[model samples]
Target chain A: MSEPPQEQPRPEAEIDTPPRGLPQPEPAAQPPVPAADSGAAPGPGAGAAPVWGAGPPAPPTPQRRRASTVHVLQVIALVVGLVGTGWISSEHFRTVWLGSERDEPVAVDGAGAATHEGLTVSLVEATDLGATPSLPGTDWQPPSGFHAWRVVLDAESTNPDLFACDVALVDGGGRHFVANLFVDSFVDGFEWTFSCGVPEPDDDVPAQQALLVLVPADAEPTAVEITSTGFSSGYIELEID
Target chain B: MRRRWMIVGLAALAVVLGIATNVADARLLPYGPTSSTGAIGEDAGAYPFTVHVSQAQAAHTVLVCCRFETPPPTGTDGVWVVVTLSYATADRPRGASGTGLVLRSADGREFPVSNRTGSGGWLAGPDIWVRGDLAFEVAPDALEGLTLVFDPGIQLYGPMPTQYARIPLDLDPGAVLDVIELSEEQILGAGER
Candidate 1:
């Protein structure tokens, strides 16, 4: 074999000389050996400047700043949403539990007057008209299975205009009875009108009317309820004897 | 920029939720007028019979159109309004008795049927078709927005609920109401015309 080719000396500049105007990297006593599989390009930080040695770290990225801001806003929104939900729940609970109790009806005696919606209602007397009640105009006859009761009342409306009211008799068993219009025509002692308007307040005269209610012979009325046609909540109840 | 977009999306969602809540309340709540006034001749009854308004006339003195065993009562001060109602039904046969009729004015004043007048023929019957007139005495000034109200005599142990049909009157409030003389033919042919 021809004598092996003699090794040539490498240029000095390629080995140790640094580029102009850049700081020289401190050389290690034993240079790091590249791996056998290392590709043509250098790996990260292999030939690049070290983090501590890099020029005043690159300014924070816009994308990163935006992400941090969104995170803070999300935390704030969650707190607000939680607080609002709590407030609404508490308010609803307070109304349902506390408001209804205050509106319960108070009881009053038969002769006593109960006031509601600026109107006063008093029951003067209640009489059980036994079977064979007298007819007002000889035209109609009382139907079978029915009993009649004469109810006298005094009512006055404080409203400027006339007020119409509904008068009903409630039996002890929670059954309702409307006044008999047929008998109502003949009874003369009543001062108040049923479907008709109740007179406005007059200092000299009290508005009084009588109504006749017919019910099944078995009904035993325990109370009388009077209210405006449209206003159901505003009412007065009188306990009957 | 992302934070702003998130806030905008949240606001849009909140507005949508608020609107939905209000819509639900209006439909589900039991408040407000349950029924509105219908045109003349429309079936306005929630019960078995269908009621129709044929004609409404105002007069100072009303002639009792239908013959009764006892003559009807007369009005004293205000003008009388005679309302002719026609009742008919095909499938559901119902009879109405003691219908509490009243006239309500714009000022909240109510004029009940003159107990002294009007025929009770249409009050209770199983007949498929019946026509009758109801009279109310109301002040002339109370004519604007005059509405005829019919109560379906509901017997209750407690206070009466607000349930009734309202029929609007079509007469002019300011015009003079002449004396109306109903011939036997006019009185008998109430719903026909």
Candidate 2:
């Protein structure tokens, strides 16, 4: 028979400390066994193997690193694409189709006062010139001694009409210098030209206001009786020169 | 599925860019250039009479005639006239070659005309007038300067010029015409002179 079991515990066993007033715990130890006898239980060499976070630092896996790099590259490409598209769109609008042409009313003091027997005259304002008939990209330059201006006339029923514009040289003077201008009449409408006086010693005759009148071969147009011209119902561009 | 979406997005972007580029180019193009193949005259059946472009050149000279049953009016606003030119592009022409208009008398003398005018009323007669640099034709590989000559005395409402003719133009040798068109309109609210 086995010797009677000793009731006293061994003194070599140790207990963990109880910090301050915490309870003490007994040391727990696992028993080591041979693999063959322990039914494939962990042997001495098995438990020594390392886990992912418990070994020497390892370089990132090829699969993970490749995935991260691809994601970062894709993000960079997206940002660049957005920026490039935005830049191109902005350039197109800012430098291309957007145009700056404006029509303002200019008063031509006296447009059709001269009435030579053979000459018939009418007046038209050069506002909205962009809408007039002409070769694209053409610009009008005033003739020498002409100040640029526009007029409104009574072209209510005139055809084959030629345009002549004038402004008073002296305040309240009866004589007016004609502006170098021309307009052609067609069934649809009309377009005209006006000269801003030449550069040197420019005529500084201030127009009393913008004015227009129509003169037929037989009729002499006066400043006050002038009515209106095409499209520009009552617009004018007066130059004081 | 994500890759397909990305491809579609890129394609859409490409299309947008193409359209924008086209619009930009159009904006930069010049205005209407004068034409070369058309003629300016009355509709064959509209007026009691008809007008023809008898000649054109650096100084265009057209023949006037009355081709109708009723005679042209001899009063004001009875006849209106103008000369129109055609070009390849509608753009501002270049140089001092773009100025000057003069009405020539039967005597072959030229009068400096300030601008286009409305005769107090239409007058009837087969008369010729001349306008310069005011008309031009811009064609590929060539810029044609033109002068339009017509009868300013005939009214648009009353009658057409009495003589039949062709527009005489002073153009370079071997230069051919492209197109030109012309018409007349009654003044708003105005009676025939």
Candidate 3:
């Protein structure tokens, strides 16, 4: 009553103070620090304390989370892609190294002997018969535009059983020529001998055979290939001079 | 580190499995029989039938004096070889076609059976004992170390590996083969020795 006791003005610091039991607003830069003296449990209370400051801690700066997720996805894709590429490359190499190797003929020097499956073959000599070559006993002559070649070889069988083989000539242009069959008169007259199949080899000597091949005059023989009749993969090749 | 080891283990397993598959595929492929030769009178089982060579003779000429539904062409001048065989089937009887007789000289010349001579012995079905003669014409000088090769007919679809029954016709180098004549009835009926 003496002029309503003349209410006194509050101090500035007291005017700015928040009410009790309400959360205090923290600075924008620093998150609110939890009260260690308080009896609250650790984990849930610590998480809630950050939410009370600066409007939920600015949603944890979404850039870092998104960037980490993208990084993990990129790593997974890279690993999967690398495994797939490696598998494909390995298969390609396997086929090239093993599967496709048979198409190439086995290479041997002109004087070397090539062996396969208990059989050995060597080219002794190759003779090119010029045009108008004479037959030993017959008056017959080779057809025009065709030339003859006589191939001499030694075939030895190391196995106890008999061995049969085939002979073919590969020209420089990759053409194959078989032994002449139609010129029986000349073959029979010349006394030229060939072993169709070799008997078991003796300790001292192997069977020697001769073949007569007729080819066009322009063909140039590069190699002679010998193969077993039953198997196509195994072969013996001897280069010609 | 454990995950890395797991990945490496899986990769190794994949490679092993691939190699195993390749090996299995190679092993399972169909292969032909190895080339083989047998003597006369030996039972050379060429599948579906068994072949036996009883006798071989060399002759200067072959005369087909037999009656025929279709008489074969006549052969002259060249040396003739007569080969006798008894073909029998064990389980299933099969009719066979084509000639499998070939004459091989010591120098590796091959002369097939002559179609000119008439021999009525054709292949028949199972349990049937068929005997007949096949004649081949060759040069007179080709008689030494003459061998008759019997092979089964070739298969068009699969591998055609030839197994030969080599019957040595031990003809004297200087011996003269006489001219022989056979009647059509004698040739058609089980051949006369």
Which candidate tops lDDT?
3
Q: Candidate 1 recovers what fraction of true contacts?
A: 0.00
- Compared with the true structure, all predictions reach lDDT values of 0.59, 0.31, 0.60
lDDT of 1 by residue, A125-164 (tens): 8888765676454443344545568888877666544356
TM-score of each: 0.34, 0.25, 0.33
Off by over 4 Å in 2: A1-60, A84-180, A183-241, B1-5, B12-193
**lDDT (10s digit) by residue, model 2, range B112-145:** 3223322111212111111122323222222133
Model 3 segments beyond 4 Å from truth?
A1-64, A89-92, A99-116, A131-144, A160-162, A172-175, A180-186, A189-207, A229-234, B1-193
Cα lDDT of model 2 by residue, A30-107, tens digit: 243333445665533455332221234469999989999999999999999999988875764555435423443334
Look at candidate 1 and tell me the lDDT of residue B104: 84
- Which candidate should be chosen as best, given DockQ against the real structure? 1
What value does the interface RMSD of model 1 take?
Answer: 13.8
For every prediction, compared with the true complex, DockQ reads 0.04, 0.02, 0.01
Docking class of 2: incorrect
TM-score of chain B of each: 0.62, 0.21, 0.64
